[model samples]
Target: MFKKFVLATSLAAMALSGAHAAEITFDEAIAGATVFEFDGDGDMVVDVRFGTDDPEGFNTVGPGANQTYISEPGLEGTTLLDTDLFVEFLGGAVGTLSFGFATIDPDTSVNFTVYDDNDNVLGSTTALATFDTGGDFPEALASVSFAGLASYATFDFFGVGSRYIIDNFNGTFGSTEDRTPDAVPVPGALALFAPVAAGLFARRRKAKK
Candidate 1:
């Protein structure tokens, strides 16, 4: 009986250890601190800017103007600003991308795509919302998996050209590499040896008698 108890305890410990593994959060990701400029390639220009009109005027664009243009002429139709943020997971595990965006035109649709380092689209989603017209902000969230991705090195975010005001943009990737262990009882293995343990115990009890 003591031996059986020890075996069970060891199994339980193993399971618990597996379940308690640590996982990487979005903030811990290396690409989390990166901020990409839309249309910074000087190819196409878009009339969009970021930041408040506070005294600090901490805007992404130059002075006097609240909007910045892509300035790229080749990018005429469907102007999209794309940035490649590299992220790598050491272990081969499932990973997810979580992101949220606020837009001005609630009626217009926006497309978000996740791409590998090679520029292949792994996943994409489009959000359509009714225009508030009152200038209120509407938010949307999307998540994607890292399975079958060309490479885990980089992910891309493509913003569809529209008068969309984006704020509070955040992204996070989660992985199962840090899942807590599950204590699964090995009933089959235990049953296979149960008869032997029972026989030994009976023999010992008979000797005592």
Candidate 2:
């Protein structure tokens, strides 16, 4: 199961505003798998938590000339099935992201998915990408966007030996999407179902006994 533990304040934070938008270029790409936190335009909360399935998959390359970044995944004849790239865009902004890709094998594909605070999937896309050693993409368009205001999103890679590199991650965030109600306390939730649960527990114990 996809599981994540979050704080009540973080959930509450999303209710604030969605007018702000922002993006990261990793122009100052860190050398390893680490979390970088920054505030978006007008103070929206944003974070990029870079990670890898194979320790080698987490790669951060040049904050190249003209403020560019190369987010390269390490895999030669291997596969990565899920979000090796995770982002948390709080403060309710609807946003889009673009990247510069260097290389990907012909048979390899990558998937991107965005999620709301309640873990509802907001958007998804799969692509069969290609690139040569010389590198590709002078394309300057927002290729990915959220369905609504999202609290977090993920970029995953898949396919055998799908080693690819991407850079120049530019994102734009605007108004927020329709959001779900925040989670209620367990005690309050239990108030409605407590009696039913007790009955079931007792019946199960009785049967076992």
Candidate 3:
């Protein structure tokens, strides 16, 4: 009875830990991939549309983090300005979200806005000095984070003469059972569970003897 109880508890804890966060590095993504449903859900995770008429949506991956970052296509001479990247959380609202940002232009300020499920603005933030040639394009990239229950977010690069990119997008889901396809079990919880499981097995062996 004790062994069964312990086993059940340990499995429950691991299950709970597995559902807290979801992340996307975009390494597995193709250069022009538009939608990213990290959890394999039909819901739209990200929409990379540039404008209404441009069908070549979803900018190609940038030259950073092993070419894993999503970059702005060369539209400098075109009519496109103040380009924005949108990420939608169609499953449910997330408690927090963060991403890495880089730009070719120095001291560029990028604006981020979070919206609730109703499309109401929840909050906003501006990240500056995204790229200073500190190391490489993605190295030393600016880290931007927003705290709130958000259903979607937009990153705007207004008047940025050069190109910019974002990678390592992460979100903490509001529901503990919400998770992504690549989401892993929490390391701390796994460590704690290992000993408990071992002890339970040992106790069961002794009881059998």
Candidate 4:
């Protein structure tokens, strides 16, 4: 009897733990997405060179030759503005996407867009704040609620690129409800276990007698 009680209690505890184990976070949700860092190196040139100087006007020499600056069209000899970094999430479900970025100037406007596998726009939003002249990296967050999106991709700082740093992109799909395996049990499960254990103990006692 005691053993049966202990076993039942253990199973219950395990079930509870398993059911609540899965959690969604900003990073885990969008792991499938790709990340592109512009001027990630200390170079004064942009990754997607357009043949001209950086429009953001950042000229500091850093660890790598890549300089962190915004890209804009009409910059002579510059492909930076035209270059669009993309990421695809193979999972064909709707989820949340998020990332952090700081604009080069306080007054500069920033835009973000999400696209599906077929290159269709899912949703988009613009940052209310203008990133114009301060060096401070202000973090911006954007999200879209979509369903049945074939692929997940994003375009950041669209139109008039700004010196920006982006990271921590994530997407989450799946029920928010707790449905871990251990939490599920057979009907009359606990009651059945108790009786079966008791019957075995009784049979052993009778045999000894």
Specify the highest-TM-score model's number.
3
lDDT of 4: 0.40
lDDT of 3 at 185: 53
The candidate, 1 or 3, that scores higher on lDDT is 3
Model 2 earns a TM-score of 0.51
Location of the lowest summed lDDT over 10 successive residues in candidate 4: 70-79
Which digits, one per residue and each the tens of the lDDT, describe model 4 over residues 30-142?
Answer: 22223322331224322211111233332211112122232111011111453333444433334445544444334433455666667787776666334332323333555
- How do the residues 101-176 of candidate 1 rate in per-residue lDDT, one tens digit apiece? 3333344445555555566666666654332322234444444544443233322333432433322222221232
lDDT tens string, model 3, 1-209? Answer: 99999988886885665423455555444444444344422133432222212244445355543322333221111113453566666554444456666656555556777777778887777666433344344322334334345667766764443555566565554234343433455579899999999999999999999
Cα error, residue 119 of model 4, in Å, equals 2.5
Query: How far does residue 74 in candidate 1 sit from its true spot (Å)?
Result: 29
Candidates 1 and 3: which is better by TM-score?
3
In order, the Cα lDDT scores of the candidates are 0.35, 0.49, 0.51, 0.40
Candidate 2, position 83, lDDT: 58
Task: Order the candidate numbers by TM-score, best to worst.
Answer: 3, 2, 4, 1
lDDT of 4 at 193: 92
Model 2, 1-209: lDDT tens per residue?
A: 12333554554565443322344544444445435554433345343444445554445553223322244321121245455666665444344555554333455555667777798987776655543322342211225656555666666656653555555444444223333333223577879899999999999999998
